[model samples]
Target: METLDKLFEDTLRDIYYAEKAILKNLPKMARKANSTELASAFETHIEETEGQVERLEQIFEMIGKSPRGKRCPAIDGLAEEAGEIMQEAKDDMVRDAGMLAAAQAVEHYEISRYGTLAAWAEKLGLSDAVPLLQATLEEEKLTDQKLTELAVSEINVEAGNAAEKNETNKPRAPKKVAAK
Candidate 1:
């Protein structure tokens, strides 16, 4: 019979893997982003992510376990989707929009994972672990909020305008109305 302690450890490993995976991918996302702001966001996240990993390691030490990670399919799929956006969206504005969306997806995933881990730590009476997890959770939320502000302020509108302009430039087929 597995206990809450085992489940807590397993969840910890999952987010640990996810944060490490994110660190590897953030650089590519930064390079691919057409927006200077978007690129900077990714770059800043890389540093913050490094700190988040260290915090996770601290939690592991607190519980007397080695810092390790299990494979996380959620993050893998999100990273793959982001790669597809970079490859598929040719226009700078359109690509920025896609990249921003991809980043938000990742932030949402991390927010959920960290929030749950913090709650579980509290439940399992691992009081020391809760604050570290919560801190990371707050960072994830702030990242998500920043992405939302960027999307609303610039990316989405620019992408939409580009699409609209392109559509207007294209030849439209004439519609035939019969039996009026």
Candidate 2:
């Protein structure tokens, strides 16, 4: 039977890959964000992600394992979909909304993963790693909450207004050029 330590190590590698992938992708998300607040949020999270990566490295040291990443397909797919959102959204406000949604998806994924890792660490009696995992978990939750606030307070309303304006200004189908 695979031991809990083995499972923990496997999960650590998964999140290590996820954090590295997020570090790579956050800059693009920041550049594409339409709202100043959204862009700043992405930039700030990049720093936080860097710290999270360092924490993962620390966890590897505590566990006597070399810090390395395993391919995490979930994060890869999420990042890919975020790219698609940028391409598909024509309106700036709507694009910002999409970016926020994409960011939340990432945060939610991290929160879930970190929460699981923390639980596993605790169960495995890896007392030292538990605090580190919990710290990242809390940060992910806070980031998710911030995205929620931004969406409700600004981005969603702006997107709705933009969509409304687009509908209002839509050119009427060239009045049926009735064939003579």
Candidate 3:
């Protein structure tokens, strides 16, 4: 069985990879977003992700290990799906909704990873690392909540309206001619 310390280190590398991937992808997401607020949110998160990466580096230093990332397939898959959603969606409102959903998916993944790492750090008595992990975890949770609020407040309703408009604009069957 892998020791808890080893597991913690492995997870750290995974999240480190994820954060770097996110930094590269956020600009695309921001550009694809229809709402200015949504775009701004993505932009803001990019800076926050930068900080998270630095925090991960600090954790590595605390443990006397080099700061580097291993392959994190889960983040790769999620990012691919998010990109697909942006490309596939044509309507602005609908695309915004899709982007919000995709972002929330990423945030949720980060939250889970950070939470686990923090717990593992605590269990391994790496008390110094716990606070760093917990801070990232909290930021992930807050970002998720903000995405939820944005979806509920505007994006979802706008998408619904767009769907309704499309349905209303569809061609209808011709009416029968009147019989004399």
**TM-scores of the models, in the order given:** 0.97, 0.93, 0.93
lDDT of each: 0.93, 0.94, 0.92
lDDT of 3 by residue, 33-111 (tens): 8899899999999999999999999999999999999999999999999888898999999989988998899999999
For model 1 the local lDDT of residue 116 reads 87
How many residue pairs in model 3 have overlapping backbones?
0
For model 1, name the residue pairs that clash. none
lDDT of 1 at 159: 95
TM-score, candidate 2, is 0.93
Judge candidate 3 against the unseen true structure and give its global Cα lDDT, from 0 to 1.
0.92
Which candidate comes out best when scored by TM-score?
1
Q: What pairs collide in candidate 3? A: none
Which lDDT tens digits does candidate 2 get at residues 1-180? 289899899999999999999999999989999899999999999999999999999999999999999999999999999999999999999999998999899999999999999999999999999999999999999999999999999999999999999989988776666798
Worst 10 residues of 1 by lDDT: 1-10
State the lDDT of candidate 1 residue by residue for 1-180, as single tens digits: 198888889988999999999999999989988789889999999999999999999999988999999899999999999999999998899999999999999999999999889998999898988989999999999999999999999899999999999999999999987986
Clashes of each: 0, 0, 0
Instruction: Give the residue spans of candidate 2 off by over 4 A.
Output: 171-180
